[model samples]
Target chain A: MIGRLNHVGIATPSIEGAIAVYRDLLGATVIREPFDLPAQGVRVCFIDTPNSQIELIEPLGEASPVHAFLKKFPQGGQHHVCFEVPDIHAAAADMAAKGATVLGQPRIGAHGTPVIFVHPKSMGGVLVELMETPKGDHH
Target chain B: MIGRLNHVGIATPSIEGAIAVYRDLLGATVIREPFDLPAQGVRVCFIDTPNSQIELIEPLGEASPVHAFLKKFPQGGQHHVCFEVPDIHAAAADMAAKGATVLGQPRIGAHGTPVIFVHPKSMGGVLVELMETPKGDHH
Candidate 1:
């Protein structure tokens, strides 16, 4: 079952520009510096809030998945929402049983935890990432 | 300043279908039945997660803002992200000082709280709604 609302992903052309908006303008103070996740094909930054996080991601290369998204939305936009699940493999099975398409086998996500994506078609046009509840995470 | 993520507003053509995906398929257990919010020009349903809520919205009339979004997406999509701010008036002033466009004066939102929207042009092409934190609610 879905647990906490983990974070909302926003695909942007520049993480620094997105940081300016979220940090200086919106007053988000605790922010993580941009870091590249070659496997995820993104230069990612995290803006932490009281409850969840705002993930700002920029395409790291031409083959990055967000490359096409950035083309469609030049100024970038909300890309997906991630929720914590108790178990990754079980969640994948649940998705399959319910006729939802899991993007691939559970893989390590930016959080360093196992995660899988349910296609937007199955989630009603929302790309939903199911992240296994991190070890020691109470929520 | 932004506080908790109040909710993510998802525009959907059918609240029932969205509910089926969130509740039955995704195992989201606590769900509030759909209700009409005529002033907001949409019917709303809430899927409660441990931390935040997922708001599913369906345009109530042709004049509804989401009506235009549905035309472009047909299948609906993530419409906007709402965050709680400590003081609505101050937040609006801050947005103004930051050169962010506030759509209009703070008005009552679906949550019955004063909320104002920043144009997508300002929030990195993400429509952001700032709502006054509900009374006595601690994140």
Candidate 2:
């Protein structure tokens, strides 16, 4: 079951610029600096919002999943909604049992958080991401 | 200043279908039922998450904002992020002073909640919505 709304992912052309806007204009504080996740071929930055955080995603390579997204929707925009779960594997298995297609096997995401993506086809054409915060990572 | 992320807005083809996916499959419960906002030309349903809610938006008319988005993207996807603010008018003025273009004057949104949107171009091309919860409407 979902524990919380972890973060909302926004795909942007430049993480630095996004960070600046959220920080300076919107009064959001930078929670984390840009970090590269080579496996996902993307660089990410987090901005602290009131109740949750805003994740800025910038594709690092041509093969990044976001690359295709950018091509189809040139306008950078909201990308995904990630829900916090107690156990990623169990949540994914439950979803699979309910006829949802799991996009990838559970794997370590940014900052060693266990994450899995649910296919858009099974969720009314909206991509959903589920993440389980590692033990002792609570802020 | 923003307090926390209130919700993430997702544009979907069918609000009913999205409700099933978020509730039955993803373990999100429906804290709010479908509500129509004629001014915005969309119907919305909210799925409760611990930190925030996932707002599913369905365009009601051809001229609806989500309608145009769907026409261009075809695939339903994340639409916008709403940040909770203590004062809607103050937040809008502050954002405008910081060079962000306000979509329109702050107006009552679904459930009579005051809300305003900032232009995507001014916010790193990601549409950002600001909302102020009425004192008596806190959930």
Candidate 1 chain B has its poorest 10 consecutive residues by lDDT at: B130-139
Residue range A1-139, candidate 2, lDDT tens digits: 8877878788887787777787788887556878999999899988776567778899998999988878865657778778788888898889999999998799888758889998878877667888997688554
Q: Model 1: which residue pairs collide?
A: none
Please give me the total number of clashing residue pairs in predicted model 2: 4
Candidate 2 at residue A60, lDDT? 92
Question: For candidate 1, what is the DockQ?
Answer: 0.91
Q: Encode model 1's per-residue lDDT on B1-139: one tens digit a residue.
A: 7889899999999999999999888999999978998877999999999899999999999999999999999888899999999899999999999899999899988777899999999999999999999887765
Off by over 4 Å in 2: A136-139, B136-139
Quote the chain B TM-score of every prediction: 0.96, 0.92
After superposing candidate 1, which stretches have Cα over 4 Å from the reference?
A: none
Candidate DockQ scores, in order? 0.91, 0.71
List, residue by residue over A1-139, the lDDT tens digit for candidate 1. 9999999999999998999999888999999878899988889988998889999999999999999999999999999999999899999998999899899899998888999999999898999999998899765
Q: Model 2 misses residue B134 by how many Å?
A: 2.9
